[model samples]
Every structure is written in C-alpha cells, then in structure tokens.
Target: MGVVINQSIKNTIITYLGFGLGAINTLFLFTRFLSDEYFGLITYILSTANILMPLMAFGVNNTIIKFYSTFRTRQSQNTFLTLILFLPLVIIIPFGTIGYFAFDAISTWIANDNALVKEYVWLIYISAVIFAYFEVFYSWAKVQMQSVFGNFMKEVFHRLATMFLLFLLYLEVITVDELILLIVIMYVIRTCIMMVYAFSVKRPTLKFTKLAKLSDILKYTTLIIVAGSVANIILEIDKFMIGFYNILENVAYYSVAIYIASVVGVPSRAMHQITNPLTAKYLNERDKVSLKELYQKSSLNLFIISGFIYLLIVLNINELYKLIPEQFGSGILVVFLIGLAKLFDNLLGNNNSILFNSDYYRIVLIQGIFLAIISVLLNIYFIPHYGLNGAAYATFISVFLYNIIKVSFVYRKFGILPFSENTLKVSILIFISTMAFYFWDFSFYPIMNIGLKSLIIGLVYGGICYYFNLSEEITKLLNKILKRT
Candidate 1:
C-alpha cells in the first residue's frame, strides 16, 4: 500500500502536470493560434494513431505485465522478454508494407470527408508505430515495479514537447504543417527516451531458448491485441468517425471537450501504473485477499478523487468554456457526458488490472470486442444525426455499459465488489456537491471565476469527505498533511 500510494501520488502529480500543459495547448494555444481545420486535423491524426497503436505493438505492453512475473528461471525470463521485444515486428512490418503499397487507397478512405487528412495520413502510421514502441518499453519498465519515470514519460514528456512546438507555431517560427510534422517527430523522440530508460532499469538479454508456457504467452498476446485494440477503439473511434463523417473542425471541437472531461481519469491512470503490476503479482500468487483489498481500496480512493474532478468540471464547465473560443463552447454537454463516463471508469479502480491479468482475460476480451462493435455502430448511427453531441452520446453509452460489465464480471468471478458502504456515502456527497455548486457562480472573468469556484468546491467537498470519513486512506493522508503544515 505504501508503494502504491507513494507512486500513485507522484504519478498523479506528473499526470496532472502533463494535463496542465495539454490544457494550455488544447484550449488556449491551439484554439487561438491554429485554424480550426488544422487543429482538428492534428487531433484526427493523433486519434487515428492511438487507434492503430495496439495493433502495431501486438499487445506486448500488456503481455509483459501479465507474464513477466510468471517466469521463475532467469533463462526463461530472458527468453520471454526477448520474445516480446521482437513480437511487434510481426504486425509492424506487415502494416508498414501495406501502408507503403496501398498508401493511396488508405489515404483516400481516411480523407473521405476531410480532404486535409490525406496529406497527414502517413504521419498517423508513423506516430502509431512510435506510440507502440513507447508502450512496449514503458511496460518493460513497469514489470520491474519502477513506473514513476515511465509515467512521467507517458504523461509529461510528449506534452511538454507539444507545448514547445505550439509555442514555436505561435512565434511564427514554424508553419502549422511543420508543427504537425514536429509533433510526430516528438513522439519518435519520446519513444527513444523511454527505450533508454527501460533498458537502464532492466537491460534485456537476448535469448533464443524455448520459454516454458510459450504457447500460453503467445495466446495471451494474440488475444490481448484484440483486447487492447477494443479499448483504444472505444476511446478514439468517436474522433475517428467524426473525421470520417464531418469536417475536420468538428474533431477539434470534440477534442477540447474530451480533453476537459478526461482530466477526471488522471487518478485512475496514475494508480494503474503501480497497481497493474501488483495485481499481476497477486493473481500469479493466487492471493485473492490482497487482490480484493486492492480492488476495493483503489476503487474507493479513485472515486473519491475523481468525484471531485467530475464536480469541478461539471460545475464550472460553462465558465471553463468561456475561456475557450466560442466555437468550442457548444461542447458543454460533451464535457458533462464524457466527464460522467470517466467518473464511472475511475470507480472500477483496478478492475482492468484484475481482468487483464486473470485467466478469464479471454472472456473480457470478447466482451470488449462486443462493446467496441457497439461503440462503432453507435457512432455511425449517431454522429451523422447529432454531430459532436452524437459522438459524446456514443462514447458515454459505450463506456457506461463497458464499466458495468467489468464491475459485474469481477464481482461474479471473484466474489468481491469494489463498492462498500462508504461507496454509497461518497456517491451522495458527490451528488450534493454538484447540486450545491453547479448553479453557484460569481460575476468575474472566466479564469478567475473558475479558480474561485474550484477553490470553494474543493473546500466544501473535501471538508465533507474528511468529516464523514468517506475514505480512511484519504482521511489519514489529509490529517498527515495538516500536521505537516
């Protein structure tokens, strides 16, 4: 728990810092400096790359975490590690070849609605390949239980690079086209840095020795490719479909809303880094008690923290939008819906880790594939009819159903649920806070208004949670902080 909390705290800070830079870039700089079409094009390119990442990496990131601990012998571990290192080539080589041979067809299909996307189609492939290797290396580090630096690279490094590029664009030192190209270059550089750090932590030994359970490892990796792809598809498909069905600018507007909403998930993202490996360790040892405790504690803490973010975003969304361009203001509902969905995601806690690391991962993979299909169908049916809001609806519905399924599956399989009596109390607190703060506002500049309102909400919400002892872990931490102060 100490390790989890320590790393989670550091990871939370790093992730938020990255998100802070992203907010500045997405809301202030990109909106102000770049034209809407180009902004959306950038968003589309990155989203497409994200969608393609799992395929290119061939699920090696997840495969490493799940199997790394299972190998007992050093020789076996070396062989397993070596296998994952080169596994990605299986998909990357073929995908690159296809992209090279069928570039025109691929570009034409992707640029159906937004012709601007054609020029940047290749960047998506390049960035996805970079993103894939970055994850592969990051997972290499994670299996060693050293995730803070990897988390920083994942959350902070590239965003800072993007911030620098955006500033360059603002300074008129780089064209928007150059800014986009440089962003791809930044991803490649980020991957290189992560590779170096991963090796520093645990240098891989190339071994061609036959690994025990090689068949199971290969099977997991193959299934996880679909599982990983399903997760990314559910996340980024809305943006991709938006580009396919509408103009690129719509993708820009949606990106801002999604970014604003995604801040709620930072805690979950941060906690997952350490918890994932721990969850894998516990499952490998068949330590169901420790696993259940982790599941509940993680869920409770994440809900408590993410609940506040959801309130802050939902309550101050109108004012937050005021700071952005008016064209993006239309995404207020997008923010709310997606924010709610992310809050639900946080409530699932280490459920993802539990599922992915467990033997029943194949079942969850199938569920994910079903949900991914539903996400696509919903987007296809809704985006054309409702525009940006339609995309939000599709995402909200898919994620909501997906989380419910995960939570239920975990409970059914493990006889442990992430919820407790305090879960109900925390839910009530969040609802009350929303009602209390949603309509409360001051007449001031949007930035000041946001700051002041967020402060008040934090005070009130934190006070109630602490007073009621909704979360013992958070309460203890808060008391420790107060004493230190």
Candidate 2:
C-alpha cells in the first residue's frame, strides 16, 4: 500500500502535468490555430488508430503483465519476455499487409462521412503500430515495478512534443499536414525512448528456449485482444462514429469536451499503472487478504481524490468553457455527463485490474463484447439526433452500466467489493459540495472565475477531508506533505 500510494502520487502528478500541456493544446491552440475540419480530422484519425491498436498488438501488453509474475525462474522469465515481444508481429504483419492490399477499401470505410479523412487513413495505420509497441514496452517495464518514468513517457512526452509542434504550426513554420506527420514521428520517438528505458530496467536476454505454459500465455493474449478492443471502443468509438455520421468539425468540438472531462480520470489512470502489476502479483500469489485490502483502499482513495476533480471540472465548467471558442464550448452537458462517467470509473478502484488479471477474464471479456455492442448501437441511435451531446449521452450511459456489471461480477466471483464505509461518506461529501458550490460563482473573467472557484472548492474539500481524517492512508499522506512543507 505504501508503494502504491507513493508511485500513484508521482504518476498522478505526472499525468496531470501531461494533461495540463494537452489542455493548452486542446482548449486554445487547436481550437484557435487549426481549422475545425482539420482538428476533427486529426481526432478522427487518432480515434480510429486507438480502436485498431488492440488488434494490431494482439494483447501482448497485457499478456506480459499477467504472466510475468508466474514465471519464477530467471530463464523462464527471459524466455517469456522474448516470446511475448515477437508475438505481436503475428498480428501486426498480417494486419499491415491487409491494409496495404486493401488501402482504398479501408480508407473509404473509415472515411465514410468525412472525406477529409481518406488521405490520413495511412497515418492511422502507422500510429496504431506505434501505439501498439509503445504499450508492449510500457508493460515491459510495469512487470518490473518501474512505472513512473514509463508513465511520464506515456502521458507527458507526446503532449509536450505536440505542444511544440502546434506552436510551430502557429508560427507558420509547418503546415497542418506536416504537424500531423510530425506527431506520428513523435510517437515513434517516444516508443524508442521507452524501449531504451525498459531495457535498462531489466535487460531482455533473448532466450528462445521455451519450456513452460506457452499455450496458456497465447490463449490469454488471444482473448485479451477482444478485451482491449472492447475497452478502447467504449472509450474512443464515439469519436470514430461521429466521424462517420457527422462532419469532421463535430469531431473537434466533441474532442474538446472529451479532453476536459478526461481530466477527472487522471488519478485512476495514474493509479492503474502501478495497481495493475501489483494486482497481478497478488492474484498470482493467491493472497486474497492483501488483494481485498488493495481493492478497498484503492477504491476509497481513488473516489475521494477523483471525486474532488469531478467537482472542480463540473462546478467550474461553465467558467472554463467561457475561455474556449463558443463553437467548442457547446458540449457543456457533454463535459458533465462524461465527467461523471469518469468519476464513476474511479469508484471502481482496481476493479478492472482484478478482472483482467484473474482467470475469470474470459467471462468478463464476453460481457465486455456485449457491452461494446450496446455502445455502438447507442452511438448509432444518438449521434444522428444529439450530435456531440448524443455521443456524450452514449458514453455516460454505457460507462455507468458497464461499471455496474464489472463491480457486480467481481463481487459475485471473488466475494469482495471495492467500496468501504468511506466510499459512501465520500459520495455524500461530493453531493453536498456540488449542491453547495455549484450555484455559487464569482463575477469575473473566465480565468479569474475558474481560479477563485477552484480555490474555494479545493480549500473546502481538502480542509474537511484533512480535518476529518477521512481515510487513514490519505491522512497519512497529508501529514507527510505538511511536515515536508
């Protein structure tokens, strides 16, 4: 738990710093510098690549984490690492070839409604390949319990690079198309740097000698492809579908709202980087007591922290929107809906880690496939009528229902819940705070209003939590911070 908290804090700070850079790009630069169509085109391209990344990687990223702890001996671990490293080539080579032979058909299908997307379809392929290997290497480091630097690479490096690229575009030193291409190059560079770091953490000895449960590893990886795809579709398919059903400009507008809402999820995203490998370690060791404690602590702490973020985003959202262009600001409802969904996601704690790392993943994968189907249907029905707001509706509803199913499954199977007494208390505090401060606003510019409101909310929320000593872990962390100060 100490390691979890320590790394989680570091990872969370790094993730937010990355997101801060991204906010500048999303809220100001992209909205101001790039035409909406191009903005949308970029969003559409990346979303498509995300949805394809799972298929291309063939789940090697997850397989590495799940099986790494099971191999007790050094030789077996080396063989395991070497084996998983090349497994994705099985999927990547074939997928790339298919894309090459059927480029026109593939491009046309992806560019269904937005013709501007056809030219960039190849970029999607390249980006997906980069995205796939990046994960493989990141997970490569995760099994070693060295995630902060990798998390930085994952969350911050690319955004910082993009910010630089966006500025170059603003200065007319580069065209928008060139900016997009440079972004892909940046991904390639990021992945290479991560590869170097991961190798330094635990140098991989190329061992071809395989004398272990290779079949089990292959089976898990095969199934995890669907698992990864389902997760990606639920999160990203909205943007992809919006590209198909609407114009490219709508994608940009929706992207901005999604970016704002995604901030609330920073804690969970950071925590998961560490919790995932830890959960896998516990499950592999059959340490139920430790596992359950991790589940509950992870849930409560994540809820308290992310719930504050949810308040900050939802409460100041109006003022925040005032800073952005009005066209992009239309997704106020989108921000709230998806922002709440993100908070709900945090409430699940390490539920995803438990499910994905456990043997029961097959059942959960089937459930995920079903939920993914529902997400697609919801988007299809809603996007035509509601546009960006409709996409948000689909995301919120799907995520809400999906979290319920996952939480229920974990309880029914493991008989452990992620919630604790503090869970309800945190829920109450968030509700009361929302009610208390939501209608309260400052009469000032957007930046000033946002800052003042955030300060009040943070003080009120943090002060109460610290005074009450809400969770022992959180209180301890606060004490440490105070002493250091």
Candidate 3:
C-alpha cells in the first residue's frame, strides 16, 4: 500500500494536470481556433484510431503485463519479451498491406455518410499503429514496477504537445491540414520517447529461443486482442457510429461531453498504472488474502475519489455548460449518464487487472465480446433515434452491465467483493453532498460561480469524508496534510 499510495497520488496529480490541459484544449482552444466540423474530424480520427489500436499492437501491451512476471530466469524473461516486441509486426505488416490495397474501399465505406472522414481516414491507421507501440513500451516499463515516469509520458506529455500544436494553429503558423498531420507526428514522437524510456528501464535482450510456455503466451496474446478490442469498442464505438450516422460536428459535441464525464475515471486510470503489475505479482504468488485486500481498498479509495468528481461534474454541469458554447450544451444528459458509468468503473477498482491476469481471463474475454456486440447494436438502434444523448445511454447501459458481470464473476469465483460497509456510506455521502451544493448556486459570473461552488463542495466533501473516516487511506492522508499545514 505504501508504494501504491505514493505512485497513485503522483500519477493522479499528473493525470489531472493532463486532463486540465485537455479541458482547455477541448473546451476553449478547439472551439475557438478550429471549426466545429474539423474539431469533430479530429475527435473522429483519434477515436477511430483507438478502436483499431488493439489490432495494431496485437495485444502485446497486455501480454507483456500478464506474462512478464511469470518467468523466473532472465533468459526466459528475455525470450518472452523479445517475442512480444516483434509479435505486432505479424499483425501490423499485414494490416498495412491490406490498408494500402483497399484504401479506396475502406475510405469510401467509412465516409459513406460524412465525406469529411474519407480524406483523413489514413491518419486513423497511422495513429492506431503509433498508439499500439506506445502502450507496449509503457507496459514494458510498468512490469519493472516503475510507472510514474511512463504515466507522466502517457498522461501529460502528449496533451502538452497538443497544446503547443493548438497554439501554433492559433497563430496561423500551420494550416488545419498541417495541424492534423502534425498531431500524428506528435504521437509518433511521443511513442519514440516512451520507447527510449522503456529501454532505459531494462534493455531487452532479444532472443529467439523457444520457451515452454511459448504456445500459451501466444494464445493468451491472441485472445487478449479480442478482449482489448472489446474494451476499446465499448469506449470509442459510440463516436465512430455517431460519425457514421450523422455529420462530423455532432461527433465534436459528443466528444466534449464525453471528455467532461471521463474526468471521473482519472483516479482509476492513475491507480491502474501501478496496481496492474502488482495484481499480476499477487496472482503469480497465489496470495488471495493480499489480492482481496488490494481489491477492496482500491474500490473504496477510487469510489471516494471518483464520487467527489462525479458530484462536482453533475452539480456544476449547468454552470459548466454556460461556460462552453451553446451547441455543446445539449450534452448535459450525456455528461450525467457517462459520468455515472465512469463512476461505476472506478468502483470496480482492480477488477480488470484481476480478471485479465487470472486464468478466468478467457471468461471475461467471452463476456467482453458479448458486450461489445451489444454495445454496437445499442448504438445502431439508439444514436439515429436520440442523437448524442442516445449514444450516451447506449454506453452507460453497456458499461453498467459489463461491470456487473465482472463484479459478479470475481465474487462467485474468488469469494471476494469490492464493497464493504463503507461503500454504501460513500454513496450516501456523495448523494447528500450533491443535493446540498447543486442548487445552492451564487449569482456571480459563470467562472466565478463555478470556482466558488467547487471550492465549497470540495471542502465540505473532504471534511465529511475525513470526519466519518469513510476511507482509512484518504483520512490518514488528509490528517497528515492538515498536520503539516
């Protein structure tokens, strides 16, 4: 817990910094500097690339995390590492060739409804490939139990680079087309830097020697491709489907709402960087006691943290929208629905890490495939009917059901649940705080109102949580900070 708390706190700060920059870029810069259509196009390109990232990496990112700690000898570990490093080429080369040969058909199909998507379709593939290698290298570092630097690179560096690019766009130093192209180059550069950092952590000694579990590792990697793709599809498919079913600008609007809601999940994302490898280590040692403690503690801490974020977003949503453009205001419901989904995701804690690292991963994979299909079907039926709000509903329902299944399976199999008596207490606290602050708005300007309201909410929420000792970890930290002050 010491290392977990230390790194998670640092990673959380880094992640929030990144999200803050992203909010400025998403809410202000893109809205001010770029036309809505191009903004949507940029969102569409990135979301589409994310959907394709799993295939590009061949699931080697997850493969490294799950398998890296299994080998006892350096020789075998090097062999396994070497295999994963090049495994993506097996998929990448063929995928690239296919894209080259079928570029026209692919672009035409993707751009059927919105012709704007066709011209920049190739950027999606290139970005996906870049994202794939970046995750692989990041995982390489995570296996060494050193994630703060990689987390910084993952969460901060790219957003800062994007900020610079946005500034360049503002100055008319680059055309929108060049801005888009440079975004791809930015990703490529980020990946290269991460690769350098990963190697510096532990330089891979490439070896071709066949290992005993080579077949098993390959099988896990192959199955994980589907699993990883399923997760991404659940997250990004809404944006892609919205692009396909409507104009590009709607995607931009929806992206803003999604980004706002995504802030709730930041704690989970920050914590997972360190928890994932730790989960793998626990499972490798068959330490169910430690694993269960990790699971429950993670759930409680994340819920407390994310619950505050959810309250902040939901309570100030109206004021927040007032700060953004009116067209984006229609996504108020999108924020609530998606924000709730993210909140539940935080409650799952290390559920994903446990399932993915354990032998029960195959079951989770199958369930993910089922939910992915359901997600696509829901979007198909909903988005055309209800617009962006409909997409939000689809995502909320899909993620909600998926989390339930994962939680149930973990409990049934391992006899452990992510909740204790304090879980309900946190929920009640969140509800009370929301009801208390949401309607108690000041008559100031939107920015001032938001700042004042948020400050009050944070102090109130922190005070109550600390007083009740809802989370021992959080309470101790708060007390420590207070003592220092």
Candidate 4:
C-alpha cells in the first residue's frame, strides 16, 4: 500500500505534467503553428497507429504482468520472457508484409475521405510497431516492481520531445513534414531507451526452453489482442472514424475536445501503473480479501479525484475554450459529453485490472469484441450526421456501455462491488460542488479565472473529503500534508 501510494503520487504528478505539456501543444502550439488540416492529419495518423498497436503487441504487455508472478523459478521466468519477446513478430511480420504488398488499397480505404493521410500510411505502420514494443518493455519493467522510470518515459518523454519539435516548427526551422517525421523518430528513440531501462531492471536471460504453460499463454495473448483492441478502439476509433468520414480538420477539432476531456482520466492512469501489477499479484495468489479492498479504495480515490477533475473540465469548459482558436472551438459539447464518460470510467476503479487478470478474461474479452463492433457502427452512423459532436456521442455511449458491462461482470462473477457508502457520499458531494461553483466565475482573464475558480473548488472539495473522512488513505495523506505545513 505504501508503494502504491508513493508511486501513484509520483506517477500522478508526472502524468499531469505531461498532460500540461500536451495541453500547450494541443491547444496553443498545434492550433497556432499548424493548420487544422495538418493537426488533424497528425492526430489521425497516431490514432490509426494506436488502433493497430494492440495487434502488433499481440497482448504481450498484459500477458507479462498477469503471468510473470506465477513463474517461481528464474529459468521459467526467462523462458516466459523469451516467448513473449518474440510473440509479437508472429503478427507483425505477416501483417507488415501484407501491409506492404497492399499498401495502396489499405491506405486508400483509410484515407477515403481525407487524402492527406495517404502519404503517411507508412508512418502509421512504423508508429504502431514502435508503440507496441514500448508497451512490451514497459511491462517488462513493471513486473520487476519498477515503474516510475517507465512511467516518465511513457507519459513525459514523448510529449516533451514533441513540444520541442513543435517549437522548431514554430521557428521555421522545420517543415510540418519534417516535424511529423521527427516525431516518429522521437518515439523510436523513446522505445529504445525504455528497452534499455527494462533490461537494466531485470535482464532476464532469453532462454528458448518451452514454457510450462505455452499453450495457455499463446491462447491468452491471442485473445487479449482483441480485448486490448476493444479498449484502444473505444478510445481512438472516434478519431479514426472521423478521419474516415470527414476531412482531416474535423479530427483536429475532435482531438482537441477529447484531449481536454482526457485530463479527467489522469488519476486513473497514474494509479493503474502500480495497481495493475499488484492486482495481478493478488489475483494470481487468489487473495480475494486484498483484491476487494483494493478494488473499492482505488474506485473511491479515483472517483473522488476524477470527479473533481470532471467538475473542473465541465464547469470551466467554456472559459477554457476561449484561449483556443475560434475554428477549433466547435468541441465544447464534445468535451462535456466525453467528460461525463470519463467520469464513469473512473468510477469503475480497478474493474479493468481485475477483469483482465482474472480467469474470466476470455468471456469478457469476447464480449468486448462485440462492443468494439458496436462502437464502430455507432461512429459510422453518428460522424456522418452530427460531425464532431457525433463522434463524441458515439464515444460517450460506447465507453459508458463498456464500463457498465465490465462492472456488472466483475460483480456477478466475484460477488464484489467497487462502490461503497463513501462512493455515494462522494457522488453527492460532486453533484453539490458542481452546482454551487458552476454558473459563476471570477471577472478575470481565462487563465486567471480558471486558476482562481479551480483553487476554490479544490480547497472546498479537498476540505469536505478530508473533514468527512471519505477515504481513510486519502485522509491520512491529507493529515500528513497538513502536519508538515
């Protein structure tokens, strides 16, 4: 628990710092320096690549975390690592070959509505390969009980690199093409660094000995590809579909709105870093007592934290949009819709961790494939009609439904719920806080207004949670902070 708290706080800080840099790049730099078409093209390229990442990864990342603790001997661990390390190529080689042979048709299909993306089809493949291995190595390190460095590499390094490239673009030192190209190179370098760090943490000998559970592992890895894709598709398919249906700039608009709303997910991102491996451990050990406690506390903490973030984003969305360019301002409704969906996501706590790690992953994963199909259909119908808002509508509905399925499944199988009396308490507090603080603002510039309003909101929110002891862990941490001050 101490390790979870310590690393979660660090990861939270790092993740927020990265998000801050991303905000600058997305809201100010990209909109100011890059044309909406180019921004949308870049977003489309990355989102498409991300959708392919799970397939390229072949689910090695999740497999590593889930299975690593079960292997007791060094030899077996080495055997396990060796298998997963090369498992991705099973998909990558054939997939890449087909992509090469049929690049024209595939790129044409993806770039159907937006031709600007055709030339960048190769970049999408390269980026997906890079993204896959990065997660593979990140997981390698995670099973070593070391995640901070990888978290920094995951969250901060790439964005900071992109920020530098954006500045170079601003200075006329690089063309947009060069900036995009350099960004791919930046990710390659980031992944290589993570690979090195992973080995530094645990350079398990690469042995080719047959793993004891090769059949089970390969089966899980293959199934998890669809499962992982279910998540990525839910997250990024909106942008991919937007690019498919409309011109590229709509993706930029949708990307901006979703990016703002994504801030609401930062706490979950932070805590999941440590909690995931821990949850895997508990599940592997079949420690229901520990699992239940973690499930609820993580939910409570993330709900409390994300609920506050949700309020900030939804309440201040109008003022927040004032700083961005006018053309990109069409996503205010997009932000609101997606913001609520992300709040629902946080409310699930460790639901994702538990489900993915449990024996029932197979059934839930199959269900996820259906939901992925549903998401695509929703996007197909909505994006053509409502444009950016249409995409948001599809995403909000898909994510909300997906979360609902995951929670219900976890409860029905495990007979445990993530919610508690405090969850209801936090829900009420969030509702009251939103109504009280919203529809009112300081008479100041957008930044000043956001900061002042957020400060008051934070103090009030934190004060209420602390005073009521809604979360003993959080309350204790707050007590420590108060004592230090």
Model 4, C-alpha of 126: deviation from truth (Å): 0.5
Question: In model 3, what is the error at residue 184, expressed in angstroms?
Answer: 0.4
Compared with the true structure, what per-residue lDDT tens digits does model 4 show for residues 335-396? 88998898998999989999998899999998899999999999999999899999999999
lDDT of 1 by residue, 1-485 (tens): 89999999999999999999989989998899999999999999999999999999999999999999998988888899999899999999998999999999999998894568888899999999999999999999999989999999998988888888888988999999889889899888889999999999988899998788988988999999999999999999999999988578999999999999999999999999999999999999999999999999999999999999999899999888877789998888999999999999999899999999999999999999999999999999999999999999999999999999998999899999999999999999999888888888999998899999999999999998999999888999999999999
Model 3 segments more than 4 A misplaced: none
* Model 1 local distance difference test score: 0.93
User: Any runs in candidate 4 off by more than 4 Å, and if so which?
Assistant: none
- Tell me the TM-score of model 3: 0.99
| Candidate 3 lDDT | 0.93
Q: Estimate each model's TM-score.
A: 0.99, 0.99, 0.99, 0.99
Candidate 4, 420: how far from true, in Å?
A: 0.2
Per-residue CA lDDT of candidate 3, range 282-398, in tens?
998999999999999999999999999999899889999898789989899999999999999999999999999998989899999999999999999999899999999999999
For model 3, which pairs clash?
A: none
Q: What is the lDDT of residue 29 in candidate 4?
A: 93
